[model samples]
Every structure is written in structure tokens, then in C-alpha cells.
Target: AAGVIQSPRHLIKEKRETATLKCYPIPRHDTVYWYQQGPGQDPQFLISFYEKMQSDKGSIPDRFSAQQFSDYHSELNMSSLELGDSALYFCASSVGGGGETQYFGPGTRLLVL
Candidate 1:
């Protein structure tokens, strides 16, 4: 399976501006996850959506929002992006079941100025 896909491989946003990223999960997968990877730091989980509901928030701000549609595609919207928001955003997907493995996308690199 292709697993997942994300758009805008890279982006640059001004301080306090808004940005949107997209993600597409493979068919038959019901869970979609998002993560943020900072320079020289481990990837931190942002949120997870299963059955159209948010499952968890690992380490994300209220300004960072996400949605999963009926088609299983998801989008992450960052409002008032700051310089500290500059990082790599990754999308992943897994079956909502035991031992499910999350397969990640290429990631969107955002450089907030």
C-alpha cells in the first residue's frame, strides 16, 4: 500500500500568518495521525483521528487544528503560525486495530519567518 501522502513538500509562512497542509491516507486505513518534527529533535505526535473523532493530542497547540473527511483524507490547519512553528510536519495512517503500524508521509517542511 502507498500508505500516506502529503502536499506542499515545503512552505514558508510569515509570523502570525496561517498555513494549511493536506494528507491522504491509503484505502482501508481508518486512523490518521499527525506529528511535528523539529530540527535535531524527535518527532512529536500532534493528533490522531479515528472514526471521525480526535483521539489524542500529544504536543500541539490550539492554533494547530486538523480534520478528517468522509473520503479518509485529512487536513491540518495552522493559525497564526510563528517562527517557532518552523518544522517538518508529517502525516501517517494505520488501521484502527491491534498492532497497527503507522506509515508516514514524506512530510511538509514549514519555515515560519
Candidate 2:
């Protein structure tokens, strides 16, 4: 089984800038998971997209948004990024419409300057 793939493995942004992080889930996986890990912090669940619809959300800031495309790939759109937004953004994929034994992609290390 192939692992998840994330683009632009590293990112740097200025305060109030916008960034888009993309995720390519494993083929045939219907569930996508998004997580954020700040410096020295445990990964926090951000959101989930199932069947191209937003299925769940957790602690996602107002300035952050996400979506899943028809192709099953997902993207996180962040606007007005704050310094606190500097974190590693990870995405995972599972077989069904929820988290369970997911395969994680190497995160996008975002640094909000």
C-alpha cells in the first residue's frame, strides 16, 4: 500500500499571509484527516473530509479552512496566518469515513514569520 503524500514539505509565511497545503491520500482511501502540531506539542486533530464533504472538525482556528476534491485529495487553506500558526501540518488517510489505522504523510512544516 502506498503512503499518503503531501506537497511543499516546507513552507515559510509572513504574518497575515496566506498558505495552501495540499494532501494526496492513498488510492481508494475515502477518509482524510488533518492535524497540526506546534513546537514541542502533540499533534492536534484539525479536521476531516469524507467523500468530498467535511465530516468532522476539531479546534480549527477561524482563519484556517480546508476541503476535499472530487479526486479525493485535500487542501488546507490558511488566511491571515499568525505567528502561532507556525506548526507542522499533517494529513492522514483511512479506508472508511473515519480515523482508524490511518497512514500519515510527512508533514508540511509551516513557519509563520
Candidate 3:
């Protein structure tokens, strides 16, 4: 199957701007993998939604939120963005559940100016 797909692979926004990132999981996958990698840090597990419900919580800030739709895709909505929000946002999909094996997509690079 094809890998997860994230839109607008590269995004440039100013501080306080809002951005919506769409993630299309692999066909029939039931989980949305949301993680972020900052300037020199390892990938951090932000959160995940399984079967349209939040599966686990992480360090996601109040300004950021996410959702999984009936169709199995998800969206990471970032509002009141800050310069520190700049990072590579990644999405992945798994067949069974949140703890199952995951196939990651080419990440979305967000730059806040």
C-alpha cells in the first residue's frame, strides 16, 4: 500500500498564524500517528487517535489539536502558532491499533517567521 500522505509538504507562516495540516493514512488504517521533531531534538510522541477517538495523550499544547474522521484520515490543527512551533510534523498510520506497527509519511515542515 502507499504510505501516509501529508499536504503542503512545506509551510511558511508568521507567528500567531494558523495552519491546518491534513494527513491521509494508508488505506484501511485505523490510527493517526502525530509526532513532532524540533531543531535538534528527537521525535516526540504528541498523540494518537484510534477509530476516531483519542488513544493517548502527549505534550501537545492547548493551541494545537487534532481529530480523526470516519474515513480514517486525520487533521492536526495548529492555532496561535508561535516561533517555537516551527518543526517537522510527521504522520503515520497503523492497521490494528495505536500500538501496532506504523508506516510514516513524508513529514510536513513548518517554519514560523
Best-performing candidate as measured by lDDT: 2
Candidate 1 lDDT over 1-113, as tens digits, reads 47588998999989999999999987888889999999999999999898778887788899989998988889999999889999999999888833168889999999999
Q: How would you encode candidate 2's per-residue C-alpha lDDT over 1-113 as one tens digit per residue? A: 58999988999999999999999999999889999999999999999999999999999998989999999999999999999999999999998885578899999999999
**Each model's TM-score, in the order given?**
0.94, 0.97, 0.95
Q: Candidate 1, clashing residue pairs?
A: none
Question: Superposing all C-alpha atoms, what RMSD in Å does each candidate have to the true structure?
Answer: 1.2, 0.9, 1.0
TM-score of 2: 0.97
Q: Against the unseen true structure, what C-alpha lDDT does each candidate score?
A: 0.89, 0.94, 0.91
Which candidate should be chosen as best, given TM-score against the real structure?
2
Give the worst 10-residue stretch by lDDT in candidate 1. Answer: 93-102
Runs of candidate 3 with Cα error greater than 4 angstroms are none
Q: What tens digits encode model 3's per-residue C-alpha lDDT throughout 73-106?
A: 8999999999999999999889766356888989
Q: Mind sharing the TM-score for model 1?
A: 0.94
Candidate 2 wrong stretches, greater than 4 Å:
none
lDDT (C-alpha) at residue 89 in model 2: 96
What lDDT score is found at residue 100 in candidate 1?
67
Q: Give the CA lDDT, 0 to 100, for residue 5 in model 1.
A: 87
